[model samples]
Target: MLRNIPPLLSPDLLYSLRAMGHGDEIVIADANFPGSSIGPTCIRADGSTASEVLQAVLTVMPLDSFVPDPALTMQVVGDAEAIPEAVTDFQRIIDQVADNPARVQSLERFAFYERAADAFTIVQTGERRLYGNIILKKGVIV
Candidate 1:
């Protein structure tokens, strides 16, 4: 067990995060996400919820300050204005960890999937909530 690292971050997840350079994006996907089929390298956090995984990741990883929105969540289908409970939880976690907490951006379902497919890596979590998926852009350690 590492001293300061969140236990939820497995060795593989840590490695993936470390290997990712500035601007590379990672997807924190819900259980329903088609992680393997979408194509990016996938990591499994099978027993944990998306919120739990996000909190653990934000504890060590820095969010991109260069972008207006480094954090994004999948918008509820047919209701772009709708904010699900998971998104709220994700926003709260981001606000707590990031120095400049940017407003969470919303992406259309298919758009989100396309982005996730192009992500540097996708971490699949056990979160059961609808629209629980989120994407995070990695930043420099400065």
Candidate 2:
């Protein structure tokens, strides 16, 4: 109900994004992701697609520019060379919002899970698309 605030962002998710400091990472997980078990703080964003959640989050959150690749997506297992359709949508969203959008990097499935485990928070979306998981690093507003 807040004006200008993306309705897709739950209060908890908004707070988490605001509270995160530069370099802190947040995971936008798909329905299959075990966010509750792995994330330090998990926010439920059910009923929404990961692409929708990503676009909403990017409206307020800035992508980390200090790192070479601040946007990271989970690589398809058994087909590391393949790029999931969801990831392509993610990149398109990033390219639209980020001032200097960095190319999305692909992480091996296990590596992505390991990295998600260390994220500041994880937003579990309702996206049913396989390989919908992605991680984004926070950048200073400057």
Candidate 3:
């Protein structure tokens, strides 16, 4: 294992994150996502949950502060006002990494897919909870 690096980040993942340019997006999706078909490049952390993957990714990936919404979560179906418990938990983790910069933006399911299409890669995690999906935009180190 590498020192100071989160163990959840595999060698391939690290390479992809480093290779991605500013504004490039990365999807940390739940097990239910059809990543194999949707994601251009897919990383499988089959046994670990989405929260676990999110934590690892945040350790290395910098969130784009240039945009109003660097973090995007899936909106509740039918009821846009409803915030599921799973999303709440993920929000807490994201807030910690974001340094409380701005609130996460919720996107319609179809829009979320369109946005994720621009991601450099997608990490399909083992989180089976509904709405356990999030997309993050990469930012410059400076």
Candidate 4:
């Protein structure tokens, strides 16, 4: 175990985060997400919830400040104006970790998928709640 490092972050996971450049995104997905089928570059945080994974990542990784919203969560289907409880928890977690706490933007289902596909890497979590997924952009250490 490494000192000051969240044990949840594996060497591979840390490697991915370290390799990512500013403005690159990393998706934290729900258990039901088709993470495997989506692409080859994915890290599995199985048995862990997405919020917990986000907290762990945010402990080390910085949030991108260039974008309007560094955090993007999947919007509830059939509802654009409303946010699901799952998303509320996600926003709370972000507020807990990030100093700036980028606004959590809602994306259409298809748009969320497209964003995840473009991410530098996807970390699949074992969150059972529907729509409990989000993408976070990487920022510089400074």
What's the TM-score of each model vs. the native?
A: 0.97, 0.97, 0.94, 0.96
Query: How would you encode candidate 2's per-residue C-alpha lDDT over 1-86 as one tens digit per residue?
Result: 89988998988998899999999999999999999998579899898999999999899889988999899999998899898999
Reference-based lDDT, residue 41, model 2: 90
What shift in Å separates residue 136 of candidate 1 from its native position after superposition? Answer: 0.3
Name the Cα RMSD for model 4. 1.0
Query: Could you arrange the candidates by TM-score from highest to lowest?
Result: 1, 2, 4, 3
Name the 10 consecutive residues with the lowest summed lDDT in model 4: 33-42
Task: State each model's C-alpha RMSD to the native.
Answer: 0.8, 0.9, 1.3, 1.0
For model 4, residues 1-142, the per-residue Cα lDDT tens digits are 8899999998889999999999989999999998878863889999898988999999988898888889998888898778877789988888888856877998999999988888999999999989989999998777
Top candidate when judged by lDDT against the true structure: 1
**How would you encode candidate 3's per-residue C-alpha lDDT over 57-125 as one tens digit per residue?**
888878887898888889988988788776787778887865434567899999898877767899999
For candidate 3, list the clashing residue pairs, or say none. none
Q: Would you give me the overall lDDT of model 4?
A: 0.88
Model 1 lowest lDDT segment of ten: 93-102
Error of 4 at 128 (Å): 0.3
Ten-residue stretch with the least lDDT total in model 3: 95-104
Off by over 4 Å in 2: none
Model 1, total clashes:
0
Off by over 4 Å in 1: none
